[model samples]
Target chain A: GAGVSQSPSNKVTEKGKDVELRCDPISGHTALYWYRQSLGQGLEFLIYFQGNSAPDKSGLPSDRFSAERTGGSVSTLTIQRTQQEDSAVYLCASSLTSGGAHETQYFGPGTRLLVL
Target chain B: AQSVSQHNHHVILSEAASLELGCNYSYGGTVNLFWYVQYPGQHLQLLLKYFSGDPLVKGIKGFEAEFIKSKFSFNLRKPSVQWSDTAEYFCAVRAYNNNDMRFGAGTRLTVKP
Candidate 1:
């Protein structure tokens, strides 16, 4: 079975440009998450999606950051007018259920975004 | 706001040596604790988790963690470590009813052969 996967393993862009990172969750998974990891730092939660309900965007750093999960299977995180501080590794994860009690999230290899 | 802390930033040990990594959380409510590991050039993988029941939980790769509710701690331990165990370890915590999860700064372990 395919695990959580993210495309564009590496991306280099200007500080003022916008970039979109994509993620494909495992089949049958109803929970998806996006996180950002700075160099030598831990994961920082960005957004979460559970089934057809509204996505949780509380973890998003700013309005410039937005994410969408279409059809409840694939997700895309877009950063508008990216700043140098936005450069980091973007990781995606998915779990079988949305319950926080026993959900074991599986992570992806991550996309390393570099803002020059 | 909830947060997680990992005391050790980096650790180095020889093969067959015992290993222990400390993890603590600030949330007072019911929270799920987890330990994840990431090997070189590999994705993060779950090492263990403590949702309920037994406080002492065993995980893959001869690893285990003890969740001490009294101290708000979930420390990971391995009696004997192998060189392959060298990797980065992260401690995470999430509230039982919330979707947001917090992670520690991570501890990098290096095992000498």
Candidate 2:
């Protein structure tokens, strides 16, 4: 039903501050994703959006990381200047578009970010 | 760098016992395997997936997985285990011509009943 939905489950910025993480996809999900889960690092893959052409930042890990997917759904993942290694646990996922079909992402209950 | 290897970060059993969990990955071509579960704070569910003809795949509740392309592995088993099947197990890999997906650094099962 209503799955993927993330927000500030927890965030505590400090180092060079600049954070914004949100994602709400699943009303008709046309695909949207952003992942991060540090601490020995595992699930990492930062940007993606389908159904609107451009956006596959190729696992964005630099450029202060950036992400956006609006109009097709809500998604945001901006981590400008934030460091301390950008903390971790920022995950959002959705599926239902991406042509090749293998759908099944649906996740959200993450947003730990803590860079003190 | 398509990596995914969950060589057990933690696993303690007791319930009905019997359950294996080990996933290995490192692409060079086709791949699509998954086994995700997270029952503590919840949010990451999908107990099975192995995009190809049986290599021993069955999922949900009494999960199963075994896709061994020689040893790129994709292990996850269960013969009996329940303490609510303690949680946190993730093993993912995607690249069949893709937008990318990779995960695995999780394995926290703790089934003690």
Of the candidates shown, which would achieve the greatest DockQ relative to the real structure?
Answer: 1
lDDT of 2 by residue, B20-102 (tens): 99999988788888898989978988888877787888988988998989889999999999999898899998988587888
Each model's lDDT comes to 0.95, 0.86
lDDT of 2 at A40: 64
Clashing pairs in 2: none
In every candidate, what fraction of the native interface contacts is reproduced? 0.86, 0.64
Candidate 1's error at B34, in angstroms? 0.2
Using lDDT as the measure, the top candidate is 1
For A40-98, candidate 1 gives per-residue lDDT tens digits of 88899999999999999999999999999999999999999999999999999999997
C-alpha lDDT of residue B72 in model 1? 95
lDDT for model 2 comes to 0.86
Instruction: Write model 1 residue lDDT over B1-113, tens digit each, in one string.
Output: 78999999999999999999999999889988999999999999999998999999999989999999999999999999999999999999998878898999999999999
Chain A vs. true chain A, TM-score per model, equals 0.97, 0.33
